[model samples]
Target: MKNSAVRLTFLGGVNEVGGNKILLEDFNYNVKILLDFGINIKDYNDQYDRNEVPNSIKELVKLGLLPEAEKLAIINLYTDYHVKKNQDSNDLETNLDGIFVSHPHKDHFFGLSFVNRNIPIYTGVFTKKIISAYYKCSKTSIINNYGGLNWKLFRTGDILDIKGLEIIPVHVDHSIPAAYGFIIKTSGGIVVYTGDFRMHGPLAAMTQDFLNEIKNTLKILHQQENKRGEIQKPRETKVKLLICEGTHIHKGAIESENNVEQNLEQLFTKHPFDFLLVKFDRLDWDRFRTFSSIAQKFRWKFIITEKDAYFYYLLNKDEIHESMKNPNIIADDHILILTQGTVKYRWQEKIRQAIYKEEKGHRLIKYNEIKELDSGFFFYITSLRKDVIEKLNPNFRGAFISSSVDPYTEEFIDNNRTLSRFFRKIGIPSYRVHASGHAMPHHLINFIQSVNPEYLIPVHSDQPHFFKTFFKNSKIKVMIPNKNDRFELKSGIVNGSGVF
Candidate 1:
């Protein structure tokens, strides 16, 4: 039977940040698929009014934020509760075939509860564990009835066949641990979807593996088909469209690896403080490693919260214990500082009870283990959540370290200044000492040249036009898709002007 042409439509995450939704359809039949269901948090905040009537997805369509729905099949849920809470009620009512969660990041997978309970969710084991933790802490029973929802666990290289569509999950490097990119195969051709990624972390090797796979898949498909034939020949591997991210396209390549390490060392060496306080995104394992290395070299005790310690355990249990072997590394009073978040509250209580009962007393480090006279470094791995920082006010002191990228905006800077003022009021000198997780423009150009995809569509960025500069000399078709714009794939040519 002759196959139908495939169509891809972007609903969000096209020209701006947040609200990443896309629709895939087979023109010859009634099959439809959705890639991501995200919400624009910034937009929501701007239009929010508690006294007004709840907005619906249809209402969002009126605002040109969402696509007009025809038949919704598969919906990949990739957003958080904050966005979903403000979603028009009608949007939440759209039934879906399955929910493909990328990771546990609030911006990527926090909006799952807004959907119906019967839809199946495809995710990895690590993602499941994190989501479970999130649920436990939030006391949200949305995921408690797992019996009603099908939870499919898939690792890298696992191929899932749903209806007529084939999905292969490929692990990618990101700030979060359980990040994944996907390759969707249909009757038309293969579509590579890179959720979000970076190249300067432990997952670099994995990213290379995924790139190799894409290259191999495309090569095999080319070998089996003759492009010159009047009737397109069947190919072993065929990629009809490449849906990629352009998060940092507009920014110049900021040398991160060596520069960040050097910056950290220089700051620590120059500062003459008794206690060094470093702030970073807890999920960023690379930054964590950098901070730990600096702390160890300075002969300062590496202090982190028990909650962050758990994540460290998950990412690098061997390294954590190995560092603990050094007399300088301490867990109880000397090393691990407990945070007062809902997630940490339960774990802290449990550890406290065990310490009080002396059941596992040896596991707890004594105050004597810490050398109060010696200059020490303290690492505070946390988020921008106001509540988290408010609770951290008492113990955090001395030189402050920011090992994460701050949002770039005048308002964001003002807010950060307010935060810095607050920290200064508490006597801590704050500084930013972090690296980015997205590839810079030059790095992205190198990647595009290496992969050499026939077609490239950039998403997850505000400056999609920047791609034009990098591909100026190339013959490959470069397209900047807009929200609700449709692209048909069949004869190796893209159809449609794309939504503006």
Candidate 2:
């Protein structure tokens, strides 16, 4: 503590694909900031524990769902579901600077529900819309129930000054929209955090722009040697610590979103699918655009869940994307809205209360009505449903394409196997044409080489050690910190300790 050093702590995403929780503290400024407060993706089934979270946030900490932080806060506003404590501000008065959310994925922002109301959250504009959509659709949304967030939303290039720390959120391409990597300036020097990004997506230029802006702090190129060992190029940067994500660090087949789109077009053309049931992550708006385009091209009726319909409507206002404003898609004609159950969810019901009559339930297609459409229809669902498919077409000979996550992990393999059997029973074949949201191995190497950081701490991957091999030829140091371990960044030296 004698010299200026930033204390870094890895709470959750040390050696896992998801659940990223990082704490960065500057002793000189007495500033603490938590980055991407995510929960374990595999732990809960994308829902707050109906039993524990309703009772108390303390139970969430005991179950390892919420991190046991120094100070915490909980709210019980829903009188019917849980006891109401409308006024409780224990950790709300803490000195925590703010929380920075990378994106809208549950593994990134799910923990927002438990965050103290007083602590501000910084994120992208569209990310707020995505979170809002999820909050509306999900009945048991713990975090969204906070009613309104104390957010200082920003665009990609906007520089943020919280306390003494300077945070620059750099928009990056991920499976979902409004994702960003942060270039944070600390008293120790500069900290670079690549929040689950890739370079091959359509937004590769944005990543390059980020690199160019951080060029002073990060060397933007790497030189590889042949058998002759010839030096390639000189590198320069002022980056002291680089906390990067290695979700796809290991050797594997990785495809870009463009590649997936091309492959899906071919798949749809090859199979004369009367009805194509596509399953993807709900928040992946890029994937939604891809399917929307495909449906338009094929002249097929595109059916989206009610949740996505509202999100797309909201995204159009801010983004002004052509797909979002596509009358054929959002007008309830070519694209239809499908909600779960016979009645509307809370959000849907609220929409009906609006003064507009035409917008009330325009093209709200019933699940049973799907049987009337013989062919030329594409339906997007979170999961494939056999009953829905049977109702649409009893003979159901179309193909079901899964364009979200690939079957690389054990969990996905098992889930896909079970889904394949279900499809098989109804005379349908399942195809997986996916573009990973994470960076590819070569991209990871390129990132390490470009940043050329003094130390590279890998998180959010099962194979963190795989990065050592990639950085072996370079001076980039790869260190995998254990869960809850603290690494100090001082005098350009990354020394590890037990915990803060």
Candidate 3:
């Protein structure tokens, strides 16, 4: 007999904002897939820090860090090293089909470092490129090495058929490029998983495209329902389940991408600093582009670290979005790549070779020698590299601009506090000018109503139960799952009642 239900197990990403890992299993087709295997920031921080990482998969399992294999039931997910250390005889095989990554954020894809290399990992074209470039250039190979993993790339509108299931990847606007949401067709019904998205970014039109596609999907599913001679009302919902991220549930106002650029420009115009020290996420090319254009307006030399230069070279090599393309590292004169530290990695050699192919000498700058330069310069540095500011001329008026996501975890809060103290000790003022990568509360409300899913599952949120209040009067049933809870979908409805 064919199984008529699809089982959804919430392994992670329940009442938290970051680490997202959900398991989907099709019993009829014998297919099992993980939506996104991200790390739980608090759990990881409790056990280890940046300097220490789990040495083996067995260690992670022993510490309750990775998913419980006994609960998942699938086999062959670990390496030989783990199997050798395992006491159970059933731990010697692998059954995971694939892992679908929504984006290249550390919380979304960083857990790949622990996954078995044989299973295929799927991502958007640019997501693959960005992740590949990051692991290649980063010195911390112990944490994010993804070299030998099976990588499969997809684009918007491409339907991926795994066994008897079909998954369609659609572009969505977020802080990083190549972010996507999945429209999955299972034996049970049609399901939609909304990855982290926003409506206020420069590429908001892409998110609209996703919305329009979902509406179209609703029409098609409704037509099919009628063809099956199923007795239903005309106002029946078409989609079975809608998995959403409610990161900013209580926040009503959102800072748009344009607002970030305008605020930075206005702030700098009012209080002119001799030099600007800007810290932003490396994957956020949108923020980088904003700073790059600001450099042109002020006619200041934009300096990036070696890692940023490597990312620049990698992204520029691909056919990227129009808004992300500017201040070419090879063709532009105002852009300079900074070299620091005496030790050079294998990736740095490739960057030097690429940069040397176009220009001779003026484009590359030494780290210690930047103090000898004039006042008009924008230093694009990371939070870890704040010491670069201490090397600058003490008398040169400088201000620090933080253009990254707001603090959520304890580690992030502490890091920001430490950064502020360091800036205050040096007599340099620090300013925060950033836009969140998640959607605002109103936008999420509109999104849920537009889809009108029969069941709504909230993940990647600090207050998942707040969704109940958001849709109290609506017909949609909100399902707030606990970690490791199993929910089954059958006949276009979920098998569980409202949690709250």
Candidate 4:
């Protein structure tokens, strides 16, 4: 590691969409920071062995989920090498400087559970709350406990001055709220990392605002090159590298959330049923809002799982009523169905009290009342409970909307095929409706052009080469970065070494 070069190492987020682990090294100032250490959600141990999970940091590094940081300047909280209790007093501020998280997605933030609690982790406020909720509620072991981490909840424009590198979180719209893209000031130049953003969501303006800020910053840097010291000279003027996500490159373009929202209203109006069902992804709050808006517009009742109801309230506190906010403890006698069964999980016992009450007249309702009604209401159901599919009436005309990923992929097709058979047997019809949360090809091109970086490295994409073809003969040099490829950035020229 030389003093003049800045290094960008890709540990996982290449060729595949998740399992993102990136290391950003500032050799001149002896600073090392990890961007995101996340395991792929799609590759989660749903059908596999839970016993295979690593209980310690050494196992994590061995599994390639995290990179070895012994030579790294900072201390890691989770790893044996950097535990505060074992460290000598003189070597306290080891090599690692800080860790910046883009969002709370499992692919980006789940790995934080294994991170050294000593490292200063920077993220958004809402993202922290969501992660805490997820860790507390989820039955899956993949979501490690986040109780021990050192968190510095950075806002939209907060600049993180770690050593000599300046990192800023710029808000961007995604499936989950409080998603962000980052602008890092390094010795090589300004580097922008887009952490899974889309320009068609409700907060599309936020993404635009990020681009505008980048443009302004680049303009400012281009105008002045401070020659105060040799140390400061290499870092001055304009952005050198743009590390972006191309999730939708070859996955086909999708309409914005607005289109999906309108379609949902039309679907509800066309087929009003006794009990409509929709599969739920806990983090997909935009989808929840879409259904909520439909219920409000049609004057129909909408209910959600208590787990989801909590997140919904967090997202829509302004729209929800204060009276509906109750401590989710000790079930009420009024909740007939939720009380009938002996609930084992703490969340299960409190779910009825948490989600059954009326909120702003439409936010929360009970399953008992909805099933008794003749028609005109739908409720959200968790996919974990497969028995729920069996409980639907065979003669009912209710519709089930699969707003999450369709059965197009191999992993889901069989389950969905079985679900299709069950739905057909029951008389409840299912509908597929969803809008992707990633930028489309045209949108990607527009954003790339707007930032106008000297070098472009695509991450979280299956077809990174598509970017090369799309931006062929353009000013942007598209480099398809591979896994574990250490990129040394010196004067904006990126050279790679296949070393850990």
Candidate 5:
């Protein structure tokens, strides 16, 4: 075994949001762990022209999104387990040891195809099922290859000793099911990583459980250290570092949960239009479930696409089956919404072919299974995407319930007058309705008080200075690490300097 020093480097997701990659090196065992390998969507969109494609990592680095090729090649690369793009090379390629996926969110875990096939990927049981379903539906050839690949699905609380590192996946509340925050135990100390979480609805219980578990673990460590001899130093019990997310730090305080709920209810009651198109993030299943419950209560039929429905069915197959036994369940009221693009075109062509066969007297009859829609209030729940909304005509009145953080810069807000005007002409209302996934400043302060980590390192946001405001009088040193910065951790003290 080596000494008790560990070095951590933040390749991306420091000052800017997205592309979250952190390299952890345990000098005691010569083991390295890569946290999340993700791409900055904004950076990708900025670098690529409408028809152009980037060919190499060199191009990505030149865009100032990723690390230098030489530095990235040092450690094995592992993504959190999302693979949004079909192409394999869209993410960084390396000889990965293993991938510890938090959930099946496209941004968090979609780049798994970039890693070598031999490396094993670990995730929670529900997350594994979701990822498998996604891969099956997408029919990704890269996923099909590698002889079906290795997947180790562990329960939420199980601890694994991986290459001398004790890794524990703690379940957290997020929009998606089976989301996790990892607790990594090294010679240096325990490090808690909050993947993405919110404190609302069904997830409140899970969040509390997580806090309890961390507290218990710290207590146990303390007891063990206490039993040691007097001459021997007492081992630190508290986490040496807390890798917290600051996604909504700059936004400051957010609306209270009760206030947000009241606001939404008021909006729904006031907007008695023909159609109520509620556009929210698709992966936000809790919000979707809330909307579904509301629709059922109002006797308004729930509408969704066949693909989306299928995915939901896969996710909640047992619940659907249980609901089927109840006579009062209104399953038929849920309608399938279809678009006039690729899927619609293909379906129409198939229908036409069947109709033609019937006309040829082939003893075949054509039957229409799909129900025709006349007019009703339709809430289009989705993330705000202009191209998707353009497919629908002006006949349908809709509003966008903005759930995610708006990526608006001061310059764009001041100078881009035409953008707002164009959006108004497009018939989609943008309103902030939902709470954020990442913790706000108050929530962060609460979490810090609960966990009481010795040191805090904020990541996955632009505003690290906001943490200082919350921890102004505390003894726990709050660190704002820069890109390529390395930290030496030993006995609850973190000393580090920025690389650039």
Candidate 6:
């Protein structure tokens, strides 16, 4: 490879839905940044059970859970405490500047806990809070601790000059708040990476703002280049490459969050259930807010698991998106913190104190209290709490709403089946009311067309071929990269079209 070339290596998120680890190396500028170093959920589960996950980074790398240390070539990326235990290998060197995390999702930032504490991890301001809240609430696992490392926070519209690369993080609408897509200007060319996003989300306008910013960046790049060279006619697109996620590319326009709310309300009204049990992704604050609002609307108490309560309490402490902030989770009579198990972690005790100190009523609703509830309650539970629900002994008047994505993996499929059987045994009718976090196929196509990059590389999808098919008539060259595939981009063009 030429020293001036910009190289992109797909280490993980290829032909998969998550576990996105992309390495971008600009040797000309001496800039190396890994975008979204997250573990692929299925791959991680396949390698080891939750109870048997390795704590050491070396062990994880040996098991192919992380990028190979030799290939990364970044020294001090892992703490000496983790790598020094095994003396067979020499220490890795450094040119790696930082790992830019796009969001707080486990599939995007879970692996940070295993990284070296010295390397700076960049994340949005609210994204950092959510990740830290996750770490504080959960057991100190490799994924949860996030390595307790150096964290540099940035908000939308911030221009981060890491070495020579200029990374502009623009907020994008995903399932979670503080999700971002980046416009990175390298010596070779401009590379636009669309971190997981959707157009039909509640905050779809944020995604549009990101798209507008990309166009503005191209104009800025043109203005800067015109100063040194002959004035050339502007092309429709100037972005050298675009890396995007196609998690739901096979499906056409999915339902919007508003549609989800409408469907959920319909279900609630149709059933008129005395009490409700709801399940959603823990970090899905939008869905949590949706349910909580409905509970308040119905004059029912919104009950959340202690874990959810912890996140809600933390998020409420700061300024965030207006639609997401809710003082009710901690202060209102309409909210209840459901505590079934004894407090195990120190964080749980802190949560207990926060709730008791802030809320006036005896808001801690125990599992036994749930059984005695006659009506007017919305109990939120996580996947691990299905057994807890069984213990609650819900009445037949209760309904279960699975307000999360449908199972896509084998393990999740099996778990869903088990949950279904349990729901059946409990004699409560179950409903699936959810909106996907990813963009629909049509929206994704429109987004790529709008960006109009010289080359388009699709990741975080099982059906990558869909991108090729959709872009065949367009000018975009859809590059389907496999795991660990490397491509050299020099002077705004790929050196070779064929796989390396």
Specify the highest-TM-score model's number.
3
Q: What are the per-residue Cα lDDT tens digits for candidate 5 across 137-174?
A: 43334322222446777877799777778888888876
Shift in Å, residue 299, candidate 3: 0.8
Pairs of residues clashing in candidate 6: 75-92, 75-93, 113-146, 113-147
**Lowest-lDDT window of 10 residues in candidate 1?**
139-148
Kindly report which residue pairs in candidate 3 clash with one another.
75-93, 75-94, 75-95, 76-93, 76-94
TM-score of each: 0.75, 0.85, 0.92, 0.82, 0.77, 0.92
Candidates ranked, most accurate by TM-score first? 3, 6, 2, 4, 5, 1
Give residue 347's lDDT in candidate 5 (0 to 100): 36
lDDT of 2 by residue, 283-350 (tens): 66677777777877878878876666665665655544453454333444577776566445656654
Model 2 per-residue lDDT at 487? 85
lDDT of 4: 0.67
lDDT value, residue 246 of candidate 3: 88
Full-model lDDT for every candidate: 0.60, 0.70, 0.79, 0.67, 0.60, 0.77
Instruction: Encode model 1's per-residue lDDT on 97-118: one tens digit a residue.
Output: 5667665555455345444444
Instruction: Indicate whether candidate 5 or candidate 6 has the larger TM-score.
Output: 6
RMSD of each: 6.5, 6.4, 3.6, 5.8, 6.9, 3.5
C-alpha positional error of residue 137 in candidate 5 after TM-score superposition, expressed in Å:
5.1
Between candidates 2 and 3, which one is better according to TM-score? 3
Enumerate clash totals for all models, in the order shown: 9, 1, 5, 10, 11, 4
Instruction: Give lDDT tens digits, candidate 3, residues 35-86.
Output: 9887777777779866776776778777766787667886767544232222
lDDT of 2: 0.70
